[model samples]
Target: MSAKNAGSKPNKPADVIETGRLWQRPGFLIRRLNQIHISLFYESCKDFGITPVQYGVLTTLREHPNLDQTSLCAEVGVDRTTMADVLHRLEDRGLVKRKPSPTDGRIKIASITPRGLKVTEDMYEAMREAQIRFLSPLTPQDRATFVRMMLQLVEGNNQYGRTLLKHFD
Candidate 1:
């Protein structure tokens, strides 16, 4: 199948895409890029001792504090059970605290502790380094263009993204 017409399956042969074939495919390239980015992020962020998902949650909280578990899950693109588990871990580590929301006693509100903010801040440098490492091959001009295109694509297709993305952004 032509790369442009390829469905979810690997390029027809499954074994020979190295000839600049699958390299031109969006879905395949995007997945491969995500893998590279995640690998770089994890390898470079080990000292921060936080997973990528946790980092996303932490940064989102930094931007919008006092969000409830449901909101946090939506913001972080995690399912309820998984969010609950991660929240529990953060709470146990003293990085986050949850209490009954004043507006709704039945609902729990989550917030990053001062320590969590500090830890997140400490990780910022490593995050920048990881991002740079991931895109190191690009020229500065190309990097800017790539980021602009990516943001455009993301914002333009936000409605089609898994979890809608707004809950997190």
Candidate 2:
């Protein structure tokens, strides 16, 4: 099917459809790319003892400091339970500081600690390398178009995700 027609439901009878054609599906390709990206991210970041999600949280907090936990969860595109667990781990490692919000006693505000900032800064090159490697197979023009299209897809279907991305910047 053409790219524009790919999203439509198949008109063919399921009994006669070939399952092997799954390889050509966009969802399959995206899932495979996610697997590759995770592998490459870990291979490059293994020395730092941080997972991809942890790094994302650290970087997000670094950019937008003192975000309440709920807001942080939205910004990081994760559920509240996951956010709490991540924050607990970061707080235990002293990579993040969390405290009760001044105005809202029940809310916890999170800030990246000095060590977290340093770690994020130090991991910048490795992260950049991992991203470069992920897109290494694509030509320069293809890479740009691929990224634009991916962003378009994400924005078009953002609400379908379990957690909606909330961008503050």
Candidate 3:
């Protein structure tokens, strides 16, 4: 039987299936939402003279100082080349420092500078305000729940991010 005609007959309710457009697909919805969120976030951060990815890298380094380049790349969800470019820019700006790891000659550690921390502090309120506006549909409790759900979606599914990374790589 042809693939299209194979399921032409509808029997029991359990065996019946409905077909829909790509816009109705869950994966498409998730991807579209992510695109919208990232675009808005990047635009909001532009006033701070930093892209969203750069802000993320800075935040990651601030939270986990002295992380090596490889680790930072993973944490920031960026490729090796892009991470290198970001590190170079941040280093040039005196926002981050790269030093050879004392224990390993092959590894270089990244640490956020005081200037970077100060810049983050200055932008913190603005960023928070933008986030609030973005999530205005959600109440305070709903906002917290939404964030928790989003984290769970990203971190809970191992295959989700790994599969997405393949396209970028």
Count of steric clashes across candidates, in order: 2, 0, 0
What is the total number of backbone clashes in candidate 1?
2
Per-residue lDDT of model 3, residues 12-116, tens digit only: 442333335565455777889778777777666667787677787899898889998878877777778888899999999899999999999888899999999
Candidate 3 residue 75 Cα shift, in angstroms, is 2.8
Ranking by TM-score: 2, 1, 3
Q: Considering lDDT, where higher is better, how would the candidates rank from best to worst?
A: 2, 1, 3
Candidate 1 on 62-160: residue-level lDDT in tens?
Answer: 989999988887687677788888888888888889999998999999899999999999999999899999889999999999998887887787777
Q: Candidate 1: TM-score? A: 0.78
TM-score of each: 0.78, 0.86, 0.74
Model 2 lDDT at residue 155:
80
Model 3 accuracy (lDDT, Cα): 0.76
Supply the TM-score for candidate 3: 0.74
Q: Which stretches of candidate 3 lie over 4 Å from their true place?
A: 1-19, 160-169
Each model's RMSD to truth, in Å?
6.0, 4.7, 7.0
* Cα lDDT of model 2 by residue, 70-135, tens digit: 888788888899999999998999999999999989998999999999999999899889999999
> Candidate 2 — what's its lDDT?
0.88
Better of 2 and 3 by TM-score: 2
Candidate 1 lDDT (Cα, 0 to 1)? 0.83
